[model samples]
Target: MSIFKKVSESERNTKATIFVGNIDPKVNEIMLYELFIQFGKIKSLNLPKDRISKTHQGFGFIEFKTEADLKYVVQIMKGIRLYGKLLRVKQAENKSNDTKSVSNKPRTVDIGAKLFIKNLNPLIDEKYLEDTFSTFGEIISTSVDREANGESKGQGFVVFNDFTSSDNAIKNINGKILMNSKVVVTYAYKDDKQKTKHGDKVERLLATNAKKHKMLDSSTQPTKKQKR
Candidate 1:
């Protein structure tokens, strides 16, 4: 007998949802509902299927009536093994404000507009990085390195659609303080030798600029005679 057969329509509330990943294709909604319903009452469960083959898409969403239940399930399901795989469970990001009206096609990346950034605050993630730099231009993608435990690796890359936007970002944001940490932003280089050579040059320039700024500030201060 299917467990979902007993779920009444009145119990449905698709408010708080969580994303479940690494799902086996053989797993069905009935098995999922039976597994998750042990923690809380589920409003809805969805495993997207291909139109032609009708196989599970290897991911699903589970909606619960209350936020408390949703949180509880996420906490308990963090490392739970199912179908010989460790399930990846997390809170689903709200896409209500997403620009879905725009075309769904993937944006083209301008190789010249790719940037490499380092010394990121551990708290900064891909979404935060995107939000911080989105004002410069239409971003194609943002990626932050992470450890297996999901800790930030303090480095990332951002790609924009045009070179001008990336240039503007380097001018305005390089050496700027983000989350109490100064970050280094530079053009991403494909060759190791080029990256090292350019990195050294940028470091030297930054040091020289810092020294020049200190001298300029000291020179501008009024001496006793000048003040008199």
Candidate 2:
């Protein structure tokens, strides 16, 4: 199988929740709700706490009513300099998976008003992204993905207030050269949360391969010649 699979026409659309990680230990769900509320309507905000200390676990999950809002949070809030640390954000796994086997397919999700732009120049910053995409419409926020050492990750996101603006930017700015490299733009896959399922598949494949290797080893072993 190819390492990089082309997103199906159906996968282009999605997001409803995101996993917020690397959060400040002191941050509470109320603070999180306050911070994320600006992006869109929220469905739920959960911050697991230590049963004894009554302290947060340093990570939480936030659910938005619309995929657009969820994408906005994932894209624009990631790597944000908050509380003297950068925040890590991504799609949240299904809560139901804790009780049952996860399905390969995710639930139906709505398309968000955000775009994922890749193949970017390492030097590109959030300002450059905003400036470039602003031509299409008002940009609510922007982000340049980066490494832990503060180096650019050669990718970023641009979030518009409306889906129309995002679509326009994708149509006009996608594949355009930026800093000598052509960029790829597409709708953010904000609702995708299949990491656990993928890991399961990998484990199963390795087990199967191990069994095959054992059988081959036994079959290939030389038999002792019988005395005639």
Top candidate when judged by lDDT against the true structure: 1
Report the number of clashing residue pairs per model: 0, 0
Give the Cα lDDT of each candidate.
Answer: 0.61, 0.57
For each candidate in turn, the TM-score is 0.43, 0.40
lDDT at residue 20 of model 2 (Cα atoms): 69
What lDDT tens digits, residue by residue, belong to model 2 across residues 1-228?
Answer: 121222332332225767666455457666777888888877667665543335554456666778878777777875575453356677765544311211011121111356788999988876678678877755544666677777777887765534456667878988899999999998665445622311133433543454366522231222221000
Per-residue CA lDDT of model 1 for 134-203, tens digit only, reads 7776664566666776667788777554455666788889999999999999877745555332234454
Candidate 1 collision pairs: none
Model 1 lDDT, residue 195, Cα: 34
Q: Against the hidden true structure, what lDDT does model 2 obtain? A: 0.57
Off by over 4 Å in 1: 1-107, 191-228
Which RMSD does model 2 reach against the true structure?
19.9
